[model samples]
Target: MNKSLKHLSRNLLHGVLETLWIWRDERVAARLGWYLAVATNRMPAKYLICRRTPVDVELDAGEDELWSAHREAAKVFEETFGAVRSGELRLRELQRPAKSLMDLKVELVKRMLRHCNFCRWNCRVDRGEGAKRGTCMLDKVSRVSTYFHHLGEELPIRGLRGSGTIFFTSCNMRCGFCQNGDISKDKDNGMVVDPALLAMMMWELRVEGCHNINLVGGEPTIHLHTIVEAISLLGSVQPSRDKLVYLWMMKPDALSWRRLEPAQYLYEGELNAPILWNSNMFMSLETLEILRELVDIWLPDFKFGSNACSIKLARTPWYWETVSRNHKIIYDWGEDIVIRHLVMPNHVECCTKRVLSWISDNMPDVPVNVMDQYHPDCFADPLSPDYDPKYSEIARRPTREEILEAYRFARRLGLVFESISLEKSVFGLRP
Candidate 1:
């Protein structure tokens, strides 16, 4: 028993070390060396906390109070990005004329890299020096695990063709049962590319008839600089837009020839196609603020509604309180929002129900995809020493009964998602 325990412990520690400064390919090693040699430090004059800590969020607000808050949030959203786009929200094209918005965001991202707090980890590793903290395992050079037109993402996102997905390598949050373990668990899983090459990749996807460019990961927000800059670069080389058809543009007609008030972003050339931010939703407020105006859709995963479940399964602290609160904010801020939750074997009562209640209670309009495609993976293997018997309750696939109950519960809560796959046997269509 002791010998087996020691072997498992050693392998886990080796895994941790490999996340930092380890490379499978020598080409990435050479590029990393080049980045470290030329990259300049942009450390802040004073470092302050960038992550939102646990606070006393009143989860049990009355219907009246919740409705009032939601209304106010909607009003604020309309005023900020309404028929006349305000200067504060559209600063890129407003005040900063003749300057590249992408360049500015890229610069800010590089500076942010010096103190690396893009996610909840807040490891404060100076990635600009081309070395990331253990959790993310990505340096200044962003590695892309894969890029393709994915039709499997929920109907709205995938659309007729598919959502153009660029999956980044390495992750900040390590879920023990992550389906994409080969891509997310290791940094050496993909080819390293700079922002320029990433831009070219997006252009290729656009030419290939992709619907929207979906930024996914291993937590894609970790490579905010690369993603933002790549989008900016792609927009620049392609045709510039006359007006931005945004949140309210869900309806279209033959009124194009009649010019009323133009969409706010006529002055700037941003992403012509809709950009979807497909993330874990464990993001920084500052990062969200920077991307609020840019991202057209928010496709976030509502992992666990119980902090205890999150701590055990995803190894995160205050995951329920932190991400749920963030989800409320994101729902009101974005043009369109989609929440994806995977129903674990035993988590229906503790996690699934709570998540559904919150969404129905506060964000009724936001679409949700209650996923049922979960099964035992690398960490959950019954024979693996790393598998804790305590979690055996959720070590197997969720049953057909549980799936049916989940759909019934979601429908009972008055939640509606046109794209939420009701299919019990399908994989990848969950979100």
Candidate 2:
């Protein structure tokens, strides 16, 4: 095994010991890593694989030098061998570990500060405890514009009640078709808050009987560290099986940086909640690492197959390869990822037909959600000459046939979906 893997194994072992000690089950501690892998839909052996040598890892240690932490953890692991051999320990039986989780969260915050350039921009901003301000326009505390029960989402997300939505302000991408253009454009509406406040917000949402906390935003990647910290805090408070926290990424970047901190945090924090990524799959290898270990269900939109369309609509320079490669990565990760595409008025063929063909080739098993939600928002009026009917002289929505063709194409591609409908209407959720 590589030296980094050995170090990671040691760290994981220590984490497992801490987990068992707090949960009061030694057998579960011995097999914690395996259980985590299974729960996250990752192969158990993959835990032993080393992706990259961690930049923050200390390399000056002598061969004889062993970490005092790991040595102590090993003692506990050794003591639990009888329980493991007898097969009495169960993952379902493990109790919540509150203190160990906080310690691990503090460590995660430190690590994020050390190497937290996990966004698509990779601006190399340090956002640990002491420092402030990164490329994501955020500091130590994350500002949330508004958080409440919102019914304006897909079926599974909203369920019977609604998805508890937390809107974070400011964005990495300045997209023209942004529906929440007011919040994204405004610089003052955001309120910087600590993890405890966020945890309180989550608890408030849970008390309101929300199905899940939908982390939507200006750009979730910007305030991801704070978001993850809040997740840790909330998980530590209530270890409920029903409460799921969905991290919605409307931007079609390859992966979300939110997972980088929580991969280990999920187990160490004793969190049973699922981590959902709502992304526009702009493929990146680093994102795959996060998706492989962190995400449960991947909800991504394949915006456009044609680079010209994507460049014009989303202002993305490399749109085609990003969607194609990202779709493949999500596919390789598992069959639980969902792909969606909006049928733009005149760009149906470019967005749906071409993207659907690519999805069929790369990931046919992944569900495709065909949407018909297209209205020229304020951003598209005078600013976007191409999308503006006054400038282009095409004053009409997409024909019904274009929307129907997308659904038909998805079925032809053999893509399964929870629901493939997005009715064309104004997008809003009353506060």
Candidate 3:
């Protein structure tokens, strides 16, 4: 078939199967259904709920005290989430508290900036001072490579409208075969965006009908403060009598020419977009604590199976321990999650098989995408001036046989991955 015809056929079949999945699978429906509800304003985003749940901790509370407060507030947030999920509480009925969990998160993340431990590397460079950079090569300020409705994500993540993708600059990991090297490696590649402007970017994507606000990166974990602050700003933008004056005084040069109207900028209603944490699964436990209340869905990458392979391929230390711990935390938390495992060239035994086996043994029910789109790029690109002979093993695409074997392994494990895997061709046509 022609490309266009083939595309149409695939989409039609996909839509049909997606509808059935939503109807049949409770887990699938809860995640995608809640996202759809938030996108359509039927329900409030998780951040909005966080904004409504009250917290009594002081901004400068001691580390132990603050964490205690966070724990208590988390219980309340969970209870509230349960009520909201069960239809016992309506988003309209949720009123913003004087000092909320969202506010506390903003404070905690800012404090973390002083010591900079967003990722497991724990660079402790005092990003707030902007004097030193971390392993991610990012200071306090975040740079945005781009923001748009990205249609190229996994089926459920993209949905019909598309996943609202905001690509941040710089990553914690130095993957030799990095596909988005331009964004991930270059700290100065994109414009530095403040919290307000970042929030505006999110608002624009939602206004254009995106399903979820996908916070991706080089890695989003490095920009935890900026991202959480942006979400807080987006959720708390209520129309007020001093709105015009606020808009006039707060207009930055970046937003001047395309001055948003009061309705758009002020955002009269709750800013509703499910926060999708598209991450590398290398975030600190502290970062994950804050995220548990904010993120509506988790899209994490399980890149390496062993620390040795990770050290060699991604140049990350203690990778197996850190990534697996984070994944188990989120999975056990009962969060909506979809895991992505990229199939690389020549490491199926060391990486692919181990990753699949671990998922089967631990998180068999989580939707996984065993991706086959690896290509030679960045340091892995032999043509690049910076190419190294040591990384030549992954310099080509995975063979068709390798991809098939990976799928076969996943199938043998009885993994719940068909929705995101190539098995969609047959699974989508199922009765």
Candidate 4:
């Protein structure tokens, strides 16, 4: 592993890969590249990470960590989210008037803004006056990058009509390999719409015949006040399932559903659609509590189990403790949670193993979406002068060996998959 020897080996391997390129099959070329990298010992240093073999992976959980979501399902989760039930979860539960609900949400969100403990950073700065800020870079509120009917989500979410997606601007945990770099990194790349406008956007999406209203962002939890306010507004305007279905029946055909007649579905000015909180689980209890009633699906990224991986890629100083605690919180809530873990290049051992191990032990019933569509985008690809030596480990793509190892490890650990569509997507389609 000496530097001079490594350099010599890599040059010889590169020659072989160049010679093999004439065949012109991507998988074959990729496989050839991987074999060369392994033979040359050019794999990322982090990828070589080792852990003490577990006596029993099933037994490693903290006394409560092994507590499965299935066992806790009926007991832990309140019926608050169901249309028939009402509690502190819903405005109707408090017997508050619809207008009062919005007022109460605004009042509470303002208080939260006074000392923001929303994201994992928990930077308790006062943002009430729209003058101060935190790591998230927000002054007082949230904004939108865009809103549209997106077909590129999981099956249950996207379905036929596509998920109604609202992309919030900026992020808390800005990953180095973030695909949405244009919006996540730039604070000013998106529109500066307020909470009320966000609510209106949801209603508009419903009218457009989207399946669910999904909220995604660089990280949405950072905009606590505005998000909660918008959720409050969304709740007030939500029509019953029966109403939503009746309106849909009037549509002539599926093709006509996309360009919908809003007037037909605007009963009482209320709308109905499941709400999806597409988030990185680096959020605090305070924020989760605020949206528990309104958010129907928990679409979260349990990205890294190793602090080294997170710190190196996302610069999040406390990703492991923060995300793990948050995962436990989600499990305890007993809600519908679909955890997403994008298999990063050369990250199988250092990141994937621990993440899968933790999930297998903790939320056994929770479905994991093992995504293999991780490309070396953004800073991770080393496209230019900004590329740091530290990131050189992950600059190349992950090999077939590592990808298979991730799947094998998950299977061996008895981890339940949310979907097996990642591989299909890996080759460019989920069908």
The best candidate in terms of TM-score? 3
For each candidate, what is the lDDT? 0.60, 0.49, 0.79, 0.61
CA lDDT of 173 in candidate 4?
85
Winner of 2 and 3 under TM-score: 3
**Model 3: which ten-residue window has the lowest total lDDT?**
251-260
**Of the candidates numbered 2 and 4, which has the greater lDDT value?**
4
- Give the backbone clash total of model 3: 0
237-318: candidate 2 lDDT, tens digit per residue: 5423332332112112112112223453343333333344555554344434433433444567677778777667656666
In model 3, which regions exceed 4 Å deviation?
A: 1-27, 30-33, 235-268, 423-431
Instruction: For residues 111-139, write the lDDT of model 3, one tens digit per residue.
Output: 89999989899999999888888888777
Instruction: Compose the digit string of candidate 4's lDDT tens values, residues 44-69.
Output: 11001101011121333342322232
Candidate No. with top lDDT: 3
How many residue pairs clash (N, CA or C atoms closer than 3 angstroms) in each of the candidate models, in the order given?
1, 3, 0, 4
lDDT, residue 413, candidate 3: 91
Which residue runs does candidate 2 get wrong by more than 4 Å? Answer: 1-89, 92-116, 126-141, 237-272, 281-294, 382-396, 422-431
Q: Arrange candidates by TM-score, highest first: which order?
A: 3, 4, 1, 2
Q: Which residue pairs of candidate 3 clash?
A: none
lDDT of 1 by residue, 1-431 (tens): 59867766653322111222222323222322211111111110000000001112132444344334434433443453442322243323223323233334445566667788787777788887865464687777888777776768865455434567888888878788878877888877777777767766565454444555788878888888787777656634532232222211211221222221212111232323456788888877657755764575678899787878888888888677668877888666534676888888988989888898988898876667788788877587576666767667778999988988888898898776423555223563332
TM-score of every model versus the real structure: 0.69, 0.62, 0.86, 0.70
Error of 4 at 264 (Å): 10
**Ranking under lDDT, best-scoring first?**
3, 4, 1, 2
